[model samples]
Target: MTSIAHSAAVSAALRDGKPVVALESTIITHGMPWPQNVETARKVEAAVRAGGAEPATIAVLDGVIHAGLEDSQLEAMGKATGFLKLSRADLGYAVATRKNGSTTVAATMIAADRAGIRVFATGGIGGVHRGVEKTYDISADLQELARTPVCVVCAGAKAILDLPKTLETLETLGVPVVGYGSDEFPAFWSRRSGLAAPMRLDDPADIAALIRARAELRLDGGVLVGNPIPLADEIAANEINPAIEAAVDEADAMGISGKALTPFLLSRMLDLTQGRSLIANIALVENNARLAAKIAAAL
Candidate 1:
């Protein structure tokens, strides 16, 4: 049987009690074009290292689960085609089949927990789709957060999702949504989601303290740290909402649903927004990576 983690650096760091931040790999395989995807991956990893932690970019390659990827491995994955977009339901199947796979938020949480990592960073999380009431298409990311013992730092749930429903579901699951250094929840490309966060933590140490408290209380779930995108890079909610709505409507009209829906919406939004959305995405992810590194160090 293949073990949980195959990265020697990650294994050694875990054994040595060093700070390590878990990273998802779908950003490389499904989030962007080749060279840019590889470049962004390297930048995010560098940001984590600059903030005083090791970056474990999780992926599954030919049946082995890698907790950290080398630059060559990242380049290969970025250029490769037909990699599985793995979530909780299919992660095991991909491993068993000896296939190449990119880890989504849920899959990354599962791998991070198994590797004993306490913090993860990503661009944004998947959530309830806009018409989820009819489609019943909630992302497995929410359920993973309800049980995984890791702190996830992100801009927020993707703006393409139903932010209100996602927040409500997180509350129902007892997952704490902490807005880092901000009062309003972030809306992926926008700095504000126009919704209040369930909680707020101003410092990395305080967030780490909260995680420790959760452990003390024997809580089995993770926390969501909503770090807003940099003000300079954000496309204010008012400016971005129309584009998002149009993309959602287009997806619905074309019968785009399930895992295919998010990518489709994002692609349309990128075009509608003149590629600004992708730039904002890169900035926010790097910011989250830095904060996650700090939290992991404090832990």
Candidate 2:
């Protein structure tokens, strides 16, 4: 009666008790241009493999939620058009309607949890958008993090959002935000946000212990591991903030809102930063995938 589907690799990994890291597929279908998107996805998977875990790139294909995807399936989805960008709100609806879709952070967590996978890796998570007081456009990723038990590894909240408010919101929701090796929380492409992380734990084994302790204490929500982007690839906050601000102003001027806002802003930032943003993005995601695999293996 279970409606979920799993690729042979994932199912076998689960059966054999091997570590597996869940990857969000929106990174393929919506995060970038076709060829680069597929290419980055492959590289991310390779990073996870190199880190000693199987990678389960989660997505919904023709309305069926799949925990892992075949290479051919990934190829087709990367170039496919009109796929739903699914999050907590739309993931179930997409499945019921049999729609082709890419999973966001929240959707991936939901799928990964249902498949009994505990860890997920992603580029960045959505947060309180700039000017959220006027539009109240907080991302479902935050609330889903509060509800799901999966651990999500990311650089941090998207640099395009209001970091202070996003951090405050996570605190209010009782979600753990752990900085991997730094006191300051990361800001997506930047290594430091200038804001203190709620907690800091440097080693992956310590992080795995914290996750196990959560289970022992019967905690209900997820932990966010803020793994900073590698130093060589980072665009310092001073340099990236201006591009993000310019992109936000442009998005507001264009009246872009809801799901349309993120992709538009990201695309605009890529242009404003002369493609450095995208390069940093690819770097951070691969780094997160690498760390997530280690954490999963530890767990």
Candidate 3:
């Protein structure tokens, strides 16, 4: 394992026992356009701070795995071109090759675990894609959740996925999918997925208690806390589902697979929704960051 390069703030927070939240870098790299990406990253970090915790945005830069980035580093990354979209399989290679890369949810989990960060915030998790029986395409995020001991706070699995199967697979993997303040699992841009969440907790302290119990019981993995997007920001399921289906169908037609599939689908969805999806995505990510900060504080 590579030794992580920690920002001074992150190192101090860990030493002083202050709450700190881990944030994924792929959102800055793959999920949005340049200026907005950096702007949103700042906003998400601000949200985390407002909730009483410092945020550690994880990324790999020039052969070093950075557990947290400084502002100059974030700006450089946002403006740079051509970086690897790293997951569990490619993280070490990107570092060994002295290349830059953005951390996906799975990759972020690995970095957070290495740095001793216990919570992460992201837009949404990748999961079993639609029509996966043929592709057998399950996201490394799910597998990471089954083993990494970092609490992941997100809206839920990306709405472009097969939610039911994602939920089933999580259950089978022994990953607790906890709905924060709701019974239904959140669907990224939408408030509800129409699927009952396997577990529910309304308070951050209660969620923290669950995490602590898992540690005491020697459970190996983290919990997925589904924090719904604000009602005013949500694109209703009825309004968003068609756009999602069209995006998926288009990806199939274009033969976009693996890492390329998500960016492709998200870009298509943005076009189909006339950029409403991007707005919702920003809202949900900030919301998750706030919630994750609270959870980290609780811990």
Candidate 4:
């Protein structure tokens, strides 16, 4: 069996019964260039701390699932190359083979649950890819959300996905999709996805109560909190939609599907939007982290 290694901070937080937020590591290894990735990661961690929660940035290093990373470990992870983009399927394989891997939402949720952490903050969650009817390339993140008990706080599904279909799938899977202070679902870089949220809640304490209510009702899955990006930081939907379409088109033409698809589309959009997408991504991630901390505290 693969062992879990918790950083000192996370262990201390757990022992003391303090709020702790889980963070995914793929943003460091596959989301951006080295220095910026590391810098954004540190900023997100700081945001979580500022909200009075310890940040547990989860990843797989040398076969061990780490609930939190030390500063040096984070730095090394950012600079490392050839890391696997691990989800539920490959996470165990990476560990069995002693390979270094960065956890996606699915894998991170699993690790967070194992570590007894409840709240996870991320920029976006993977969902039904565009052309899913043809390609059938749904993300493992959706299924993870259906079964894992962690509460996921994200800006929303990435704009490149089929938002309507993703929401439909979540509904089918019985996952609660709650918008934080908005009537509409968020579209990652943008604040609106053009779909009404199934549920809405404004306060972190209310969300915490919802989580408890789910447990009380014996529901066996996670809750997704769609927190919109700050108005000042959002890339307007009108401005971002075209770029997303173009990038998706390019990926389809190039036959880039599966795990490689999201990263490819994101990188292409960065070039297409002249780096604005990355800026918005960093902002939204920090925003989500702060919200997750508050929810954790409320719980």
TM-score of each model, paired residue for residue:
0.98, 0.99, 0.99, 0.99
Which regions of candidate 3 are displaced past 4 Å? none
Sort the candidates on lDDT, descending order.
4, 3, 2, 1
Runs off by more than 4 Å, candidate 2: none
**Model 1 CA deviation exceeding 4 Å by range:** none
1 versus 4: better lDDT goes to: 4
Mark the 10 consecutive residues where model 4 has the least summed lDDT. 1-10
Clashing pairs in 4: none
Q: Which lDDT tens digits does candidate 4 get at residues 171-234?
A: 9999999999999999999998889999999999999999999999989899999999999999
Which has the greatest lDDT?
4
Compared with the true structure, the alpha-carbon lDDT of candidate 4 equals: 0.95
Candidate 2 at residue 76, lDDT? 97
Kindly list the per-residue Cα lDDT of model 2 for residues 1-299, writing each as its tens digit.
Answer: 44779889889999999999999998888889879899999999999999999999998888899998899999999899999999988887898898999999999999999998999999999999999999999999999999999999999999999999999999999999999999999999999999999999989999999999998999998999999999999999999888888899999999999999999998898889998998999999999999999999999
Per-residue CA lDDT of model 3 for 60-101, tens digit only, reads: 999899977889988888888898999999998998899999
Separate clash counts for every candidate: 0, 0, 0, 0
**Residue 246 Cα positional deviation in candidate 2, in Å, after optimal superposition:** 0.8
- Residue 190 lDDT in candidate 1: 94
- Residue 211, candidate 2: Cα error in Å is 0.7
